[model samples]
Target: MTLLFAYTSLYGQTLNYDVIRNDKSMGQTVVKRILKGDELTYHLNTKTELRVIFLFDIEYDLKETFKNGKLISGTGFNTLNGSVQKETQMALKEKFYELVIDGIRTEINETNITESVSEIYFEEPHHSKRVFSAYFGRYLNFEKVGERQYSLTSPDGTNVYTYENGICTKVKVTRDFATFEFILKPESLLAVRNKQITGKTND
Candidate 1:
């Protein structure tokens, strides 16, 4: 806790979460933030190993840069078994943002792009309508469900996030593979190991 406190006070915050599937620990996700002058950087990565008739590994990485609270660039990569599956890049332009997924490039006409999918780990969304998904190179709609909780729905599936204070404590992901949850380490590590969070469920 001392290290976490120091990190929270100095550079930024480090949130460690245990990836749970069927009440079992599969892997983990680590999120970090660094504040320097007028530039802020957020990084996140996830490692999940499970069996789908056979044993395989999956990983996802993301990095986002913000200058004066405006998104400058963001990139993400998804891999399977150490091989790259998808790569996405978003760079800021004059009045629009240049977004490239795989090798295809597109233009986003939104000015002052701020938040994306990765920022949800550090701050809670009280009235956010949507957040940009770098992996999908699109915007995902956000819906406020219960207190301090919000849901982001995409073509893939719906992801529910629960927050405390101003930080996210839990993320419930409903995907095609299976349903899993990311529980904030140490702080909520014990309370959520047994039961699921009570709130609105996507149907």
Candidate 2:
């Protein structure tokens, strides 16, 4: 019997569930944990729309399973893949293993152009947390854009680090179309990461 957790949709009008499959007890989905089966299944319901059975995951890696589906494509964790390293694991226990970074800023050659800068903060991994940050750019000079601006490159130019318990796991960047995969150890996010959106700078 697979373990299951049921959640209401954001609107509260629909229901969602995670389930495990077994041929012996088919069609009677048990709301339990770790169903003794080869695959994991998810179901979602929406108002005024047919309930959808999202893609099934034969393997729990599930990176491809969720990204390939039409209904749940952009829903979650599409651009991160990799495991945390020993260094990161050790760093997590430290009282202050924090990094504050800046994202890419650009300056156009035209007479009137806007240069933008964004700030980012990362903490040593806590128990059961994953943090993912991706940077994209127009050229290799993401680092040279401006003050307080870090380079934003695709996975090829992007580097990922997971720091926990004083150990750091580095994930090399690689592109998968509009997204990349940088799997983080869940225990590494001591605090929530600020997204890369920019705002007006102090004069």
Predicted structure with the largest lDDT when compared to the true one: 1
Clashes of each: 0, 36
> Whose TM-score is greatest here?
1
Model 1 collision count: 0
Clash pairs (backbone) in predicted model 1: none
lDDT string for model 1 (174-193, tens) is 98978999989885443323
Per-residue lDDT value at 38 in model 2:
37
Put down candidate 2 lDDT per residue, 33-129, tens digits, no spaces: 1111332222211111111254221111111111121111101111112321111100111232121113222322222111211111112232222
Q: Looking at model 1, which ten-residue stretch has the lowest summed lDDT?
A: 194-203
lDDT of 1 at 134: 75
Candidate 2 C-alpha error for residue 88, in Å: 11
Task: Count clashing residue pairs in model 2.
Answer: 36
Q: lDDT of all the models against the reference?
A: 0.80, 0.21
> What lDDT does model 2 reach?
0.21
